[model samples]
Every structure is written in C-alpha cells, then in structure tokens.
Target: MTARDLGLPSRVPAPGLPERVTIWEVGPRDGLQNEDAVVPVEVKLEFLDRLADAGLTTVEATSFVHPKWVPQLADAEELLAGLTPRDGVRYPVLVPNERGLDRALAAGVRHIAIFASATETFANRNLNRTLDSQMAMFEPVVSRAVAEGLDVRGYVSMCWGDPWEGAVEPGAVVSVGRRLLDMGCSQLSLGDTIGVATAGHVAALVNAFTDAGTPVSALAVHFHDTYGQALANTVEALRHGVTTVDSSAGGLGGCPYAESATGNLATEDLVWCLDGLGVDTGVDLDKLADTSAWMATKLGRPSPSRVVRALRG
Candidate 1:
C-alpha cells in the first residue's frame, strides 16, 4: 500500500506555498559521496533506475571531481555510460572546475552544477580558492557550459552559518549568487552547508536574493538536518515563492569538507511534508520510500529518513 493509503498526513494546503515544486534528487551523488567504502557501480546504477521508476525527474547523477577527492564516485564515467536515459528526466552532474567540466561534457551531460561558497573560509577550505577568486574560476566553466546549450546550476554553500566564520550575512550570499547568475547560471541552490539555518534565516535569505534582483523562481533551497531544521527551512523557502528544493533519498550524505554538516533533507521527508501541504511534488511517496529502504540495505545501514522508517520498517 502507498503512504496515502496509510493516511500519512491529512491534507492541509498551506496558503502561500507554490502549487508545484521541483524536487532535485541528490541521492546518487550527494547521498553517496561521503560513504567510507566505494559502492559498486552496479548498485549505484540500480539506485538511479529505482529513483526513475519512482518518478523523480531531476536526479543528480554524479560528480566528475577527481576520484582522489571523492573516490566513492570514481565510476562517474562508467555510471553515465550505463545510464538508461529515461524520457523527460534530467541528470545533472557536479563539475568543480575546467577539468571537471571537460569530463561532464565528454559524458554528454546536458546539465551541470558548480558549487561556490558564501563565506571566504569555506571557499578556501573546500575549493582552495579565496572568496573573490571564486567568480574568476566559475566564470569560464559556467559561460562555456551555457554557450554549449547546457543548463548550469550554481550551488552557494554555507549560505547561513559557516562552521569557521560563524553566521554568514544574507547580503554576502546574494552578492555571490548574483555574480554566478550574471556569469551564466540559470539557477542557484542556496545551501545551509552545516545545517545551522532556521526558518527565519531561510525566509530572509530568499527575500534578500529577490531584493537584489534575483527572482525566487530561480532559487532552490538545500538544507542539512544538523539543527533539525531542514524541513522547517524548506517550508519557509516555499512560502517565499521558491519552487525547487534539493533533498537526498533516505537522508543520506553530508558535506565531506564540512565537519559539522549532517545528512541532507530526506526526499521521503520532503515528499511527506509536501503531500500533507497539498503541494504537488510529482513524487510517488511510497515508491520513493521503498527506494530509500532498498538503498539502506545496499549500504548495510538503516534508512535515516523518518518517513521511510515509519513506512518501511
């Protein structure tokens, strides 16, 4: 039986949230990125197939960063080569720099994402670049990608509190995001890299972006659940007109570079929340939960997503 069959939540339909939201499934890449042992490429491929069968349209496939850094995803090329390109689904990969962009393009990737840091410390620690230099690095990558007729997404990490620098100013995030968009990014995913954000900060950040001429329609929220606030922050973003939310299946994955960061907002959790709110997520909650449960088995751990546990346990 489906989650709706069990009456997960009575529909309430929040007033200001968007009628439809595009959920960016980051399970394959973000969810499995930090795993200790390299998962077999076959299992990763099966995970992608399951997610597709479950109806998530925008599944982030993998990152092309050097395997030395993210060894778990070293099979990026093989995975893409084996991927069955489902009709109507978009598989976006993370491209770190020019070299990463080359790999993505060679793989025939039509959508790519570049990650930037909202704080200088994070830029140095995660990207080995100073904050100001981030633009110079991403400019060529984004510009070339867009010129190739590819959809480029910019991920602004540490949008709320930085682990080293503490609270990040909303204006700083907008400045970084505006430059990315100006350079060629069609969308920006503002990430609470350490999951320290609250609902108020989420609302303020989205408002700040809009006030700076960045439309909410072009923004997405990526929150980690370290503070038990990812779901709450997502609702706040939705209330402020943001239509895209990033989540991982089974509550897997955290920032490998950020010690304090925890697992992302789980896809099942977000789907359950949106289902109750009467927002059209276009996700099959039952099938999605099953996919998470199956992946948990593959990982030899229990699923971290609450909805998945409640439904599949």
Candidate 2:
C-alpha cells in the first residue's frame, strides 16, 4: 500500500505545506541519551544505518557533552568512528560548549549543533548559566566551528511555555534565535522542550521570527509530545513555510532537566502524518516504522509511536 492508497492528503490547499519536507532524525542522540540503560555503540551504529537505509537524510548521530551529563552517549567518539557514512547523508552531533566542540572536531565531525534555552530558569538549570552567559559561552564555539567550515545548527529550547516560567513570549524566542543565527548557525531549530505549545502558539512564534527578518526557510521545528501537541504544532510550522522538522525514532527522548517532559515527536508519527498529507519526506513509512520497532526491542520496550503501534498491529 502506498501513502496515497492509505488515503493521506498529498497536499493541503493551505499555502504553508511545501512540496518536500526534511525530516531530521534525532533518535541516536536525543532518543538514547535519556534512556536509563546504556546502549552499546554497535547498536547505535546499527540504528543509524537502518535510519539512513530507511531514507533519513539528516541524522543527529550523538552528543559530545561530558559523560557526567549524558552518560548514555558517552561513547560518542567510538560511535562516530564506527559509523559507515552513507552518501547523501549528513550526521550532526550536539556540542554544548568549546570543550564539546573540541571533542567533536577531534572525532572529525563536520556538522555540529549548539543549544540554548529561551527562558532564564531553564537556561540556569540545563546549562548551569544564565541566558546571557550561556550565549557568551557558545559564541566562541560557534565561531570556531564556522571557521572550520562546519555546518552548525542552533537550538532554542523552551520556545513556548516553560515549566518554571509558565509562559514564554515570542519576542524572547526570536531574540535568542536571531543571536544564534548571527553566531554562524546555518539554521535555527526552535524546540518546544516541554511540549506546552499549541498550533496557535507555533504559528505566532514562527511569524515573529520572520517578521523580525529571519527567513522561515532557515527555521526548523522540534516538538515534544508531552501534551499530545507535537503534530499539531508541526502542522502549524509547516503552514508558516518552515521546511525542516526534528523527530526521534520511536518517540525516544525527554529532557532530563524538565521532569514533566516526555518523548520527542516520534519520527514514525511524523512520517505517517507527512505521508497522509502527501508531503514529500523521502522516508519509507514501513521501513521507518520497522526501524522504530526494532529499536524499541533494543530499548526493551514497545515504541511509544502511535503509528508504529498501529502499523505493527
């Protein structure tokens, strides 16, 4: 059965849905890092291989943060070394600071991500610094990475409502997003870290950035399903001309700092939606779902993705 045969809409008459959408798979890094059990490096490699084979063009392979912070991905170096890079695939690793960037460069990484929080409280809790201080720390790292000819992506977390701050203003998100782009990030991924954003909030936020002179083309949306709003928020983003969307295979990530946070918007779920909408993701739905189901076994659980469950059944 094809996506069209499944009765999914190929394109909404609405203006924002693009002819093609880029799905940035974050299963390896964001998904596994939050797991209680440590995933072996070999398994990580296999997971990434399957994702690429399943048609994921961009995969967030790992994070180069200190093991004390994300022990599950402490084997970032070994994982990258073992990964067989496929043609037309880009692997990006998360780097929190200069130290993390140095480690990634030593591993021969050419793509990196730097993350910042939109709210002051989450910034202090997650990065151990205020917003200004955190951005200050990232300046040199982003600058150096750009100088090295690396593709850098900046993440603005807690873009909507913050667990500590209640409500986040769109202006605050735009400010940090603009700074990250100015610091040499090729793209800015606005993250709903706690998943409190609604479709309305998403549209407002994306427009705010665009109105502030940041092109929607340079933006991506990273949503969590904590409140079952990730897909809705993603649709809003798509309607706003944002072409990139971030998801974890099998809905496999949560913020360790945000106790209320849940798994990321599942890649399977996103693909299913995109397929139905007749949007081009370049991902094979069955193959993607099978990959998630397979990874779920490695994690010793059923995938949290609704599409995976429905397809498997």
Candidate 3:
C-alpha cells in the first residue's frame, strides 16, 4: 500500500501501522561540520558509538570534502578507520570528488553520498560549478563506485526552493533526480536546503517525482527545521510513500549558501513523531535525546531539537 492509503490522522493503531521506516542518522558528519572549535577525533568516535547504541542502523560518519572548505572534518579518514562498526549498522560518508571517493574506499566504506544542488546558484556557490559541470563530474564517480560494489546515494539540495533562485520548478528537481538515478545512484535524497517547503509542496513534488519513474522506494526526504516545517513536510512525504528520511542528531548543520538557514530536522524529533504515529524506526528515543543533549553541551549551546528540550524538561 502507498502512504496515501494510510492517510494522516492524529493517532494510529500501533499494531496496524507500516512495518518500518528507514532513518539515516547524519549527526557525526553534518552535525559537526560548521562548529568553530574543533571536535577531537576521539570525541567523534564516542559520538558515533552512542548513535549506534541508540539503535540507528545508518550513520554518516564523516565527509571527504577538502580541508580548506571544511576544516572540521579533515580527520574523516582517521575517524572512519577507528570506528568498530556494529553488525547491523551501516556507516557512510560524504565524498565531494574522486579523491574523496578514493579516501573512503581505502577505509573500506561501502556507502557513499554525492551532492549537487537543484538550483544553479547554490551549485556554483557550494560546488564551484554550474549544474551541468557538477553532473558531469558525478558520472565517473558513480560508475567507478558501482563497479567497486559500493552503494551510491545522491543528494539534490534545494529540492523544495532556493534562497536566491526563488521557488524551484518541480521539473528541475525531477530532472536532476532522473540523472542521478540513471548514473546508478541507489537512493535519491530530496533536500529542503533552506526549510522553505510546505506539506502541500512536498506532496506535489513527491507525486511528480514518483510519476516520472523515479521509484518511490529509492527516494528519501531531507528537511531543515529553519521554518519549523520539517516534520510536517516529512509527514507529507511519508504519506506519499517516501519511507527513508535523512536527519541529523540535535538538529545540526545548515547550508552555508542559504544564509541564516538553521539546522537539519532533528533525529530526536523525527523519532518522537514516528514513534507516536506507530512507525517503527528501531531508534531508542531516550538514548537519542541523551546523545543530542551531550552534543549540545559539547558545543556550549542549547539543542535545536524541541523534542529533546521537552523531554529534558
């Protein structure tokens, strides 16, 4: 059955709900990239251990971006090399180019995520290339990775709307998604980069994407909580059969290109919402809250996650 068949109600029978939803925890990488004070590699390893213990099966451990762009994650190789990966858990990392891909492969990582923005402006600003150039660069990476038996996940930023380019056309997002799938990406994550998307917009865009032969099973939604609409948009996507979600612990990370944009949707918050709706994420909410609070303390800031704050209260 599709997500539409389930409908949106305030309550659902615990036994009558969908079997499960896939949650990709992105705390270790996206959560710490923008911090001014460098987080030690050991601290990063501890954080990852807590995430695994919290019942997360997929965690983005680090990024392979150049140190000049994001110095905080310069220890990507060291970090991934040290983690004692759990049996059921999958550890993935972000790779920006061929060199980054090589680094991850050397560390024996099986999952890798590549990024490109739907808007030309964001692509140029973040990736130093136009949309066409970014796609061209991804071709060889995707091809080689597939040959190596690695799973490739594609991220299309600003899928909902862009700060500079204004409301992005649905067609533009779908076109990029198609290209990524054609390049052999096993999954496509639609990123609401600036958190400007609404529930209606999410449904419309998801419907369009699924209708265009971009298999719904291969789609995941990634939203920022900048406008307090991340959860709502996620619900809309779930209703349309988009089961995979990309969220960060403690609501960490924001797009540098999208000025003043806040954190990605908090994993703690998403877990709470899903648990209440009878959706099983295999995540321990209390443990997730504890980890989020610990990271917030390390950063010397309050958590951006409302659920974490409420639970602590």
Clashes of each: 0, 6, 0
TM-score of each: 0.98, 0.96, 0.94
lDDT of 1 by residue, 1-313 (tens): 6654694677899798889999999989999999997899999999999998888999999999999999999999999999998999999999999999999999999999999999999999998999889889999999889989999999999999998999999999999999999998999999999999999988888899989888788999999999899999999989899999999999999999998898999999999899999999888887888899999999999999999988888
Model 3 agreement with the true structure over 1-313: per-residue lDDT tens digits: 4332322225463543355889998888887888889999999999999999999999999999999888999998899888999999999899888988888889899999999889899989888899999999999889999999999999999998888889998999999999999999999999998899999999889988988987789999999988899998988788888889999998888865567578999998898788778888999888888898888888888998877777753
Judging by lDDT against the true structure, name the best candidate: 1
State which candidate, 2 or 3, has the greater lDDT. 2
Error of 2 at 180 (Å): 0.9
- lDDT tens digits, residue span 207-252, model 2: 9998999998999999999889999999889988999999999999
Q: Which structure is stronger by TM-score: 1 or 2?
A: 1
Runs off by more than 4 Å, candidate 3: 1-11, 14-17
Q: What C-alpha lDDT values do all the predictions have?
A: 0.93, 0.91, 0.88
Worst 10 residues of 1 by lDDT: 1-10
- Which pairs of residues have clashing backbones in candidate 3? none
Ranking by lDDT: 1, 2, 3
